[model samples]
Structure formats: structure tokens, C-alpha cells
Target: MSAPDRQSSFGIFQALRIRQHLVVMAIAFAAFALQAWLFQHRLDAPVPPILTDFNDYHVVGRMVAAGRAIETYDWPTLKLEQIVQTRNWSFMPWAYPPPFTMLVGLLGLLPIWAAYLLFMAVTWLLFYAAMVRLAGRATIPALFVILPSLIINGKGGQAGFLSAAFIGWFLVFLRERSAKAGWPLGAMIFKPHLAAGIGLLALIERRWGAMVRAVVLIAASFAVATLVLGVEIWPAFQKGTSTASEYLWTGFYPLERMLTVFAALHRFGVPAVAAMVVHLTCAAALVLAVALAWWRKARTETVFALTVCVCLMTSPYTYDYDGVALGLAYAMVLPRFVARAGRYELPIAVLLSWIATSNYLWSGLRQYWYGVPIITHEMQLWTISPIALAALGALVIVVLRRPARPDAPWLRAYSWMAGRKPG
Candidate 1:
């Protein structure tokens, strides 16, 4: 072949590849735009009682701003439902801590619709920033727009984006700014279940400074809330927590909407006691794995990624929207996976992405099975369980492949902090 002809052929191939890339990106963007429009439209429409998670936050915020924070949680479920209906909003149980209510209440000072829009905008920005920090600029469009979880979050007015942003940035800055990392970790008190593993990791690593900071910050948040709202807020929150726990335990919250192993078991007709035992056992195993990974000094990104997956598995109250954190975890680990091209890396990435975006699949299944009870029941079971477990399994594999070395420098540094000599 002539050199000029070969060069021309190579150029043509490169142009073709670029065009293909552009085409895929264009498609992804279009999907994002369509999803966003649908989500906004849904937000504008009145939500059903069964699907009013966002309204709960807004109402709680309004209560807090009105100095009725304690009353918000103290109201009986039926009374609360009545009030919600009277106000022409959907029924949504308020179960978050006072700190979250206070934050949302500040937003509630605005008109409800305006507050909703602003809250979503701010949380989306935080989510985008966190993604960029963890995944780089390239992933922003796909994650912020094309990911089904984002759509789920926006449509429901859920706090998943806020949790994702806090957790994502916490993981990114954890190694370098250990002390400062506690702030974002502390902010996760808004959804305390998500912070459960953060505290566990801090304690396991004997990161006393971060632990102290997190405790102080969390305490301060509550203290400020009490001062502003009144001491009664704590007891109200406790009562609400108890009610929430009962709802979860009794399956009143609907097993089909949850993504945890416990809920999956419940949906499959496992008794509540048996499901609880299985769920607690799995949660313990995941926590132990995370502790071991940190103790052995796994790579920061790997440990964070593993923890995020394990966190999702640990909590019984999670929904598909909350899997935004899992998406962030994938982002954290992607560069390493791509660089190494490990044997299972591509499959693992695909599985995680599928799980993160599985809502689209589930939605389609729901549409197809619209009025078929038996099939719909099976679909609910499948959607809530299998993909989540698959994601957890894939994460376990990734963690096993990327085992921490005892002699890693980070362990030595940690040992010094713990007043022990590194072996």
C-alpha cells in the first residue's frame, strides 16, 4: 500500500470514530432532555398520596419555618394525612431529623413551589459538582441527565441528590483532608442511614480527629435546631423515628418500593422476623468487610467505592433514587478500572451502570404489566431485589480483586496516629 493512501485511510477511520462518539453523546443528551421535561412536568402535577416523598420535606420545612417543627412530627399519621389532604397536597410522612427539617425549613420560607425549584436546583448543582470532582467533567452529562436515578430523584423531590453530593465529596476529600472530610460526612446526618458507614469507617481507622469533628458538627446542628425550634423537637423526632421503624417493620411502607435485601425477602413472602435476621446478618458482613478494607489500607477510592455499595446493602429503607450514591461510587472507581482493564472491570462497570439506571427498566416493566396482578407482583420482586444484589456482588468482586496491602503507606500513617508501630 502507498504511504499516502494508508494515511488517508487512517484519517477516515479516525473521523468515523469521532462521528460515532458524537452521535452517541447526542442521543444521550436527547434522552436527558426528554427525561428532564417529563420529570418537571410530573413535579408540576399533583402527586398521589403514595408518591409524595418530596412533599414531606417541603411540609416539614414549612412547619419549621412557622415554628411548628415539633408539631409536624408529633401529629398522628392519620391527622397528618388529613392535614396534607386539606392543604391539597399528597400524604407524606415526615421522618427526617431536626437538622434536615431546619435546612429545608429555611427553603420553606419561600413560596412552596419556588422553594421546590430552588432546592432542586441547588441540590442538582451540588450533585454535579461532586460528580465532576469524583468522575471528571466527562461524566457530568450522562450522570446528571441520562441516569434514571436522577430522574427518579427529581420527580419524587427526594433528597437523594443531596445525599449523593455530600457522600461523593466526603469520599473524594477523605484521604487528603481527613479533618475537613468530617463536615460533609456530618452533613449526611440529614439522612443518617447513609452516614452509618462513614462513622463506622472513621471509628475503624481510628480517625479520632475526623470522628471528633463529625460528632461536634452533628451535635452543633442539633443544638442549633433546638435553640431555634425548641427542646420538644428532639422528643418529636424520637416518636417519629419509632413510627417510621414500625412502618418499615410491618411492611406498611410497601416492600416493592424498597431496594434492600430485607424488603426483597419480604416481597418474596419471607416472614418479617426471618427477613430481619437475614438483613441484619448481611448488613453486619458488609460493615465488617468495609472495616477490614480500611484496616488493611485499601486504596482510598476502592475503600470508598466498596463502602458506598455496602452502605446501600446495609440500609433497609433505601429506594432506587438513593442509588445515586452507588453511581458516585462507580465514578470514584472507574479511572482505576479503565487504567488497569482488569478481567472483570468492564462487566462490573456495566452491571453497576445497569443497577443505577434500572429504574427505566422497572418503569417499562410496570407499564407492560399494568393490570396483571401476578406478573406485576413478580416484576416488583425482581425490580427491588435482583439488580441490587447483582450490584452488591459485583462490588464485592471488585473489592476482592483490589485487596488492600497491610504494608501500604497509608496504613503506616494510620498506625502512627493510633500510637502503634507499622509492622
Candidate 2:
């Protein structure tokens, strides 16, 4: 009844919540320990299944070292390199653009083990630093929230960290200046699909300086990759994409492993045309939401977070490891969402999302490596997509329902964008 009594009760409840978060984090750390051990254990095998994707990165890097960088796009040649280098094979092909090929090709300059460690080490540091910047005051909690995705990315030795870190920097910088934002956007040339959505977001928001810089950087990178690797690399990469998708239609990539609505629908035996229609429809809706969010002048963080969902939904080949950007986006927005909702359920939903993005790595390890039949292909096709849809809807709803504060300095991220004048 008294104000002092109520204040005391609120403090106590807050303390309780903090303690609960710590406990969950402790369990997560323990799980991470086990996961690290499992990754190490798999490495003892002559051809570890865990390295299949990384093998693609490393072997292609080796191709560059051996003066055959462009050949990485040659499916048989790349597969042969994997067989020779790591004695493992992947159904996935090397569809990365030349700039990324060159980056990883430099990794081929090192021994496989050293390359893996060094690549992970550098990117791990950048990823943490970038996420810290994104999390701002919520750095510690954000780390825990993204820990699952971090584990999954590390386990598979994927480029999730590098790509996600780029995204983190892009979001942080976009709020500061338009041109400065383009640097990270350009760096994402390695994964152009991911960058494309973000680029479009800037375009819709009318961040012209950023758009110019990103275009220049992208063009320069492509020109350099072309000069160094040869003109043939372009066609090779395209042909490989065609080859891979043919396999995809035949179920080479399991729907459970992919995080797109198209994959989920196709998994359930929907017709290919129907699946594409559904996916494109969802993508259109999300992109439109992002445009509207920006037009309404929502905070930069909220808009960028929504953009992440759109990128994942629009991409046909996103995997659990590739969900790192989404995970980091969730972490970046969690504090604000919690503050605004002033309730428990939104946080819980976010946590459930982390769980959803995390399980694929564990499930694959169990079924393919550890001989445990815990999760099967038939069961998880719908796991990650629903979260993407839900997050998009929630963000759009919140953006529309609640206007940004009148005094917020970031009324517009780019003053020159869309004819806005400073106060």
C-alpha cells in the first residue's frame, strides 16, 4: 500500500529476474562446454563431418593458394579438393562471390588447422566487439542471448561471425552517418544476398551517401576479384548455383537445415511453384513493412532489426549458422523491446527463437556424428521460419502503434536522406 513498500517489492523482483538470467546463462555455458568437446571429438576422425562446410571455405582458399581460385566454382574440382584436403564432402557448392573467395583463398595459404583457428579467432573477436556495440548497455545479456548462435556458428566453422559482425557494424554506423555506413555494407560483398537487403533498406530510407559508397566498394571488389581470379569465375559461380539448386529440388539440402519459408513448404511436399509463390509473398510483405517502418521514422535500431528478418526470409539458402545476424539483431533489440513491453512474454518469445535457431547444430551432431536419433528431418522444417514471421509482425506492429520520442536525436539517420531538414 505504501510507496516505500512497493519500491522495495519491485527491487526484489528485479533481483530475482537477474538471478534467473544468471542461472540460465550458467546452463548455457555448460552446454557450450559440451559442444566444444563434441567439436574437438569429431576432429579426431580422418574426415570429420563437422568440417564439411568449412572444408568448402578452406579448400577453396587452397585453390587460390594453388593458382586455381576460379576452379573453386567448378563443382567436381571443388569437391575433389575437399576429398584431398579433409577427406570429407559437402552437398553444398561454392556459390560465394569472388571477393569472399579471395578472402578465404588467403586462408588456404595456411595449414588447414591453423587456418581454421586463425579465422575463427579473428572473427570471434570482431563478432563480440560488434555485438557489444549493438547491445550498448545490455552487452552482457546480449552475449548470453546470442551465445547459442555463436556456438552453432563456431561448431560448423561458418562465415556467420564475419558476416554478422559486418551487419552489426553496418547497423551501428548507419545511425551515425550515411557514407560511413557503406563501408561495412561493402565488406559484406562476400555474402551479397545479405548485403542486398540491407542496401535496399538504406535506399528506401534514402541514405544516398551510403548507397554511393556501397556501390563503389562493391564494384571495386568485384573488379579486383575479376582481375586476380579471371573473368571465368563469374560464370563458374552462376553455374554452380544452378547445379546446387537442382540438387536442392531433389532434396540435397534438407528443409530442416534451411531457414526459409520456401524450404519449409517444399519440405512438406508442396509444389515448387507454390512454395516459391508463398516465399515471395512473405518476402514482399516483410520488405514493405520495412519500408513503412522507415517512412514512419521509427528508431534506427527497430528499423534495422526488422530489415534482418526480411533478409533471412528473402534468401533461399539461409542455414542455422547464417542465423547469426538474426540472433545479433534480436540481442540488439531485446533491451528496448523489454523496456517497452514491460512484460515477460516478449523476452520469452525471443528466448524461444534462440532455442529454435540453436537446435539444428545439436540435432545434426546427434544424428550424423554422435549416433543419437534425437531430431529428424521430418520434424523441424517449420522451426526457424515461424520465428522470422513472428518477429517481423511484432516489429511492424510496435513501430506503428508507438511513435519514437520527440527528443530523440536520431529523428533521421541521414539528414540528407529523403529531403529531411535538421531541427
Candidate 3:
């Protein structure tokens, strides 16, 4: 090929890619604008209407407002009872630790609407930033805005977006062999168990700088909590953790899903020890798998997939909203599979994403199985469950079966080819 012909071809390809990006961005902006407008003008409820996890923040926010040191376990109950006693609705006390409580309290300084906006913006930004960093250049605008996990996170008022983003960045930093880059992980301590799997992976990989910085960041959070909420609150937090565990296991909370070993045992009247054993077994397997992969020097995408799978499997209480991590998980595996030119992975991803968006999102139609009830809820369950399971199976296969290579790039931004190892 002539030099001029090659240059012209490259220019045409670049222009086409740019055009596609613009189209995607335009569509996403329009959708977001429509959503915002509807939220603003069509509301029948009060401003800042609480959704799923709003109570968590509300409990802590009120405590901060009342001048009470937030370290007390009783504060969550106090906040819950304060509303529940009069509202005739059950309130689970704020279950987050002192650091998160204080952070939410800070959020309470703004109007609830502003807080919500800030939360969404920060979470979405972090979420995509992490995906971009981990996947390299394949970070599509449509993938960001239209992902089912993203919708779930936004709808449930959960912090999965930010958590996934932070975890993604941490993994990227680890891949780069940078030590201090993992400090952002401390922000994820709101759900300490999720951090556990990732931490173990870092340690196994011998990323001492990342490990040390993560620990220090968490310690700093505790120190700040003590400074603001007092030392006495620390003991209360410990007790609160135990109390919350008991409450959760016994089905005292709303929307209990007992898929975890602990929850399953509690549901079937089995001993807690058995559940703990199962949980430990799964966690150990995950850690071992990740360590083996690291030893073989697998791609960053592989490591990320293993980390996510381990976290979910080990978590005793992963609600549907927490499935937002699946977006990151899918991102990790999708590129490598795509490189293999598989027909199924991307389509399966699209379908699972559809289900993910459809089942629990706020903005979707809830028609009765498309205006026909062919066996009612049973049919719906059959359709959704099998599909979800199949997608999950595909994800697992991709993560476990992929070959290792020594020369893969560290993931730096969202792309199918990021951290790709030569076969």
C-alpha cells in the first residue's frame, strides 16, 4: 500500500469513530435531560423523596444534625425509631461505620436535591473513570450511560458506581506497579467486606505499596471519625457491626435475599458455623485462583474479574443493587473475549444488560409480560433467572479459561484491548 493511501485510510477511520462517538453522546445527553426534566416537574412526592438506601444516610445525617457523636451504635436505632415510631414503617438503623456516617452528615449540609445530584455526578464520574482506566480506550459512551448496573445503582441510590470506579482505579494502579495509587480504596470502607477480597489479591500479588497505602487510608478514616465523633463511638461501631449482622441474618431487615451461605443457613435453620465454612471456602478458592493467575502473570482483565467474583461470592448480603459491580466485571472479560471474535459474549452481555435494566429500573415499563400472562410470574421467573444464570456462567468461563501471557499491558483506560496479553 502507498503511504498516502494508508494515511487517507487512517483519517477516514478516525473520522468515522469520532462520528459514532458524537451520536452516542448526543443520545445519552438527550436521555439524561429527559430524565432530569421529568424528575423535576412530574413528581407527586416531596422533594428529595427517599428510595432504597436513603435511610442509611438519613439516620447518620440526623445524628450529625443533633450534635451527637456518631460513633454510638444506638444512634442508628435512635434515628430509625424516631421515624418508625410515628411513621408506622419499619426503619433499619444506619448500618454504615463512623467514617461513612460523618461523610453523609457532611452531605446533609446541602439541600437533599443538591446532595442527590452531587452523589449521582460523583458516582457516575468515578464509575466511568475506573472503567476507562481499566479497559483502556474501549470505554464507549453508550456502554457507560446505558449499562443495567449503572441504572440499578442510580435507581437504588447505592454507591456501587463510585465503589466500582475506585476499585477499578486501584487495580489499574496495581497493574502499573505504582504503590500509592491504591489509597482511593479507603473510600470503599462503607462496605468493608467488598474491600477484603481486593485487599487479599493485592497482598498475594506482593503490591506492598498499594497494600500499605490502602491500610493507611482506612486508618486515616478511623482517626478522622474519632476526632469528629469521639473515641467512645468506636466501641459502639464494633457492637453495631455485630448487631447489624445478627439483624440481617435473621431476616429482620426488609428485602432479604438469602443467596449467600450465611443467609441460606439462617433461612433453612442451619448452624451459623456451616455458613461461615461455606463462605470461607468460597473466599479461599477465589483468593487461590487469583494468586495462581497472578503467578502466571495473567492480564489485568483477568485479575479484575477474579477480584469481583470473589467479592460477590464472599459477601453475605449483596442486594440486587450491588450487582452494579457486574458492569465492571463484564468490562474486564468482554475485551479479551471480543478479541477471540466470539459471537456469544457481546450479545450475551447485551441481553443480560437488558434484563438488568428491565427488571428493577425506575424508568422501564412494567407491563404484565407484554400484555399476555403465559403462566404469569412463573414464566417471567423462568425467562429472567435462566438468562441471568447463563450470562453469569459465560462470565465465569471467560475468566477461568483464558490463557496467560507475560507481555500484556496494564489497563489504563476503557478499551477491549487494554491489558491484552499476546497469545
Scanning candidate 2 in windows of ten residues, the lowest lDDT window is 413-422
Model 1: clashing residue pairs? Answer: none
Task: State the C-alpha lDDT per candidate.
Answer: 0.65, 0.68, 0.58
Off by over 4 Å in 2: 1-50, 340-347, 365-384, 387-423
Per-residue lDDT over 298-377 for candidate 3, one digit per residue giving the tens place of the 0 to 100 score: 87777777887676657766555566565666667655544442345455556655564444432233334356412222
Candidate 1 vs 3: which has more TM-score: 1
Whole-model lDDT, candidate 3?
0.58
- For lDDT, the strongest prediction is 2
Q: Candidate 1's residue-wise lDDT over 1-423, tens digit each? A: 697986776565456534543554466445445544543455456653333565666566766777777777754643464356333444345778888888878876875456666677678778767766766533442353236676667666788889988887776677665677788888888888877777777667677777777789999998998888888888888998898788777666645656677887887788888988998898898888787877888877768867886767778888777877767766655444433344454455555565645654565576666764223333444345545556645655665466455544333332332223333
Runs of candidate 1 exceeding 4 Å displacement: 1-51, 75-91, 141-146, 336-383, 386-388, 395-423
Candidate order (lDDT): 2, 1, 3
Worst 10 residues of 3 by lDDT: 374-383
What are the per-residue Cα lDDT tens digits for candidate 2 across 123-240? 8667767766766435545555556667777766788888888887887777676578888888888877777568777787688888788889999999998888889889887887
